[model samples]
Target: MKLAAAAGGTLLVSPNFAFAGEVDNLSIAWTTDTASWDPNQRLSPDPQTILKMVFDQPIDMTSDLKLTPGLLTEWTLADDAMSMHVTLRDDVTFSDGSKLTTEDFRYTFFERVNQGEELDIAVGFGTVSDIEILSPTEAVMQFSKPSPIVAQWLSFSASYVVSKAYAEKVGPEKMKTSPMGTGPYVLTEYQRDSRIVLTRRDDYWGDLPSAKQITIEIIPDPTARLAALESGTVDIATELSIRDVKRLEQGGTLNAVTNPIARIIYVTIRADGVFADRNVRLAAHHAVDKDLLSKAFFGGDAVTINQPTIPGMPSFLPDFHFDYDVAKAQELLAASGFGPDNPVTLDFATTNGQFPGDYDIARAVVTMWEKVGIKANLTVITESQWYELNASGKLPPASLFVWENGTGDPELFAGNMFDADLPFATYRTDEVTAMIKPLLKEPDYDTRIKGYEEFNQYLIEEGAMIPLLQAIQTIGYRNGIEIKPWANGLIRPEAITIS
Candidate 1:
């Protein structure tokens, strides 16, 4: 039962355990609980995982990163590329027995986040001008300019369709606790931060999942999650400790899987305070020994990155590289007119256990920077406070965070984090904004890719953000539990099946 890394690092059966047909319910313990069930409200990984089960997207991105029909049977792009015609699947109906219509798509895309709703998906949608319903089953997504990645945006979990009727009937606050959608599972109970229980929707429009019930038990401690999975109390555990992964592989009783995810573990530098100077930022970037950090903190589960965009994406330049050179970092710091006498002192903010060993990673980064004459004070904050500071543009000097390009396209990454005046953006310059503008309106795919390549390289050279590594996603599962891994690092419980 030794799992091969080439085979997605998963094992189906364990020699120590026997396959049981009575395993009709799948229980998963995760480190982070979902923030909200309302699709548009939060962009965290766990909530998006549950949203995918209870709601259907207008389109779906396959494991191989191809766009496929989900609720929409077919979709076509206009010649100008400013608009797209989407044909909905008339056979699909919401969990509330409401027929899925173009109106639902329109409301979900255009109006759901309007009236001052603080939705992150609004940024994902970019500059969508309007969603005009041509018929009950067809609609047109009109953009002010050519939107090259509109389809990709619609395929995002935040763009998952909700019954406009159900939402208006229940109101926003109530909808967060109780949601109705067209996917294979329905939220039966939600005890925030404790557990979420979902029951299989027998009358779902899509193929029913083999597991009749899915329980997402929130176990914040990684050790506790590993214990639960090893004791057979839980079928799966995510965010597993590196030590646990090695033990599972050696024992050959449980399956440990690693999916190279699209998430980039990078530091977002605020364009204020001591980090306002590009030279100081570049000095800090050079101070990071990405190789050492990945090995020490990530346990060989991560790949070091040099740019804001991650590898395996559309416009990633595979050959572009950055190496750690303490001498070069010191030179850059001295060149920036800062040395031991007037050292660059900054506070680094990060969330504890938000990502795998994030707190320790922050400490490691600070130690590395101190060698280059930059003094960094570490401030561990709660997840909510970290996000609040980032949103309000009050992130101390550098904030340790992971930005996931779930659409498999780098455009979303650029638009949300690099675009000028956007919420999460820290290094928003006219030049960077100009580079990202073409991704929205560029007609040729090659040209769009070229734009992103240039944009990412420019950011890397300018040290717009400190690129760390691709956050490797690990899954621990009991024997006979077969579940496909998602590249975006979300756990799709509906796709789980027992053999």
Candidate 2:
């Protein structure tokens, strides 16, 4: 098994996570709306506030999910880091009072993540080849493919364990309407736009969060969020603008905790998307000013990426990352037959739940392109709508889209986008296909790195998605919450403490 940690290149660590300590009853407000309670669909920030409420991620790859144990008790890897065997504590039970079984594990993958467009993150789950349920408390997962990061990727919330009983009654479609899981908190009320309320399960099987009720309010404006924090109207507000960082730090009522995310902020180029030709893709790549967007809109909170995968992933990221040059952009633009008269304009749209301040990012990117004689329209859509358009090719007739790199395993990234037949996003290349196929099933180490390097370089040469700045997902808290930053990009609510 070839385990190359950060085979891509070296990444600089952010000092923000070296926390001072924990705060109590931390309050937070979000700019996005929560339309679905179904854990299988796009999960909102509100659901996340009750860390253990809605769903618990499957702790093991082989068996049905049981909220038995996590991180601490036991996990073993075949010295090569290719295959992992997980052990669960027999003591844990779900909020519904049922014992988790391996069959439930089979149902989640065979039924949900593997089939739908919504939960394709299973591309990471595809690693487990065979499973032998040793009992209700133990299981072994064989990797059809050797991937060192499988353990870290298993930590994604998409793999959340669902109650088979609830899924059967509600059906997967309606279950999405109101989800039920073995989490620590239970969804009490969802007042659209106003608030989402959760109550701590008194009999929670895991470490119980101190707060009895987790209420998340919706505050769209950044200024209002900051004001609420200062006035004590809210406890935790997400996304601190660069301009207000100092004020929050100085104010007695609020404290800011900033950290870099394992996720990369990027513009995905569709392979078979409207602009499939290499020249057209390259034209679009050169047309945008990633640096300006990073500085002006993102306020320099983001680091630029040389390609799709984030820094320190698996391949060598180039140093070509920089500002958008109009002349060069025009040269590529003209060469692609997209001229001033034949001006190219695309609509950039994203769902509210997926990213912070993405709508603003859309507008700012538009301004960057207009300066280069190109037009970019902005639209803010729901996650479902965004994915629908992305899958159907309706959104970017040309538009702006950011694909968070490294959130899933590498094959899912390449297959869902680059595979001509089954891709969920856009873009395709024979070169991409060849590199991905062997890498998907290959268990060799150095060979996998070679495939990744070829693919990374192909992205630059092909100019698929204009690789934008790699940025951290920022989460701000009031004075009392203590939390650890996720090195690979995730916020597990149960792990946070409010004093």
Candidate 3:
């Protein structure tokens, strides 16, 4: 299917009628629900799948992970890269019938930053000095320094435009439960962690969603989601295990789909206590058998990566790899005065069912480490607990985590992962901080890409983190419905069709 423009400059999808009747409603069994209706509060991947249905970002990312116009029709950077000019679409209106303007765009970016809201997206706007409203639908962003990733940042998390007057009138606390946006869907009913219902806005300015209503049930267990799909109670089941997906596909009743997203699963090693020794870090890195982890947990579907970034990313090094050598791991452990008789013990934390095979992979890696005289005390925690620990600088020496890079930019992939100043990173060595700080603000494209390649090499040599497998989004749906997979692993109701 292709997107076409209607007479009024609205987006329209070409109709497809292959089935018997029109599909009016859709039910999905999702793994997790949004933590808050406010899009700018958290940067996690799970919330974006639901938040995008109600809000529209300044720029939209396509299924193939390419940037396209959404709320903003045009955006250009100045020659010095110190200012950005943007033009918004004039035909868009919020669900509450408020016209969208540059004032809302300015408040979404500038006013929130000034309020000191402790937002996750605030880091992306650190260099911006002021936003000059040029017209009702246009604005100019002035920067204190050259910001190369301004356009790319518009497509990242928490970049959605909010109504200036509506937000100010309702305030922050009340706005969470009653969000108004210019998207295709309107929030009709929300029951905390139980269920969420959205109705299609008939007068939306863009392509109308095929399903008139969408019902999402939060099912945390993989088996429960699978049961819902098998019993014909739900149309789509998301975040299924690889084994379950293979079994359902073989049954000939459900269609299984998988998409490799821009997320990388790795173990973050803190640079203190037992991990302060370079030899100990290197020993832990060499102990992981990525090939085995891929075959056992992912069924050979996930890619084994040596760095945090994937193959399609700009800074991915094809030849950089650390072979899984038990002998080498033991030798390194001996050099650090750690052996079977005097093993090094450390706490290793992981989350269960957060992603496909996350807990199993963490357990397998811990077993491998034990063979090399590293005794890891494994503990499973919830995602909220992990974030709480990370915020207070109390994350364990090692923890399994996934880094989401929706923009697919090297600055966000390696730049944020290795930069010690950022909250995502736990390795706080001065050497790493010095190497990554300059690359975050580099104006030139070629120089920034090259710098990350060198920085990736340094990280591998220093054994910064244990790179595991590239994440794969797996889902199962009934045979009648068609769901296109997005590179960011988001299930867009507007992109779905039924025959």
Model 2 earns a TM-score of 0.78
Candidate 3: which stretches are off by over 4 Å?
1-22
* Positional deviation of residue 69's Cα in model 1 after best superposition, in angstroms: 1.2
TM-score of each predicted structure versus truth: 0.92, 0.78, 0.95
Give candidate 2's error at residue 362 in angstroms. 3.4
lDDT of each: 0.77, 0.58, 0.84
Please provide, for model 2 over 93-199, each residue's C-alpha lDDT reduced to its tens digit, 9 standing for 90 to 100.
56678766654554564455545546544556655656567776556666766655555455444556666666777776676556567676677777777777776
**Weakest ten-residue segment in model 2 by summed lDDT:** 6-15
lDDT of 3 by residue, 299-398 (tens): 8888999887888778888887778888998999999899777899999999999988888989999999998999999999888888789779889999
Best by lDDT: 3
Q: In model 2, what is the error at residue 312, expressed in angstroms?
A: 2.5
Between 1 and 2, whose lDDT is larger? 1
C-alpha RMSD between model 2 and the true structure:
6.4
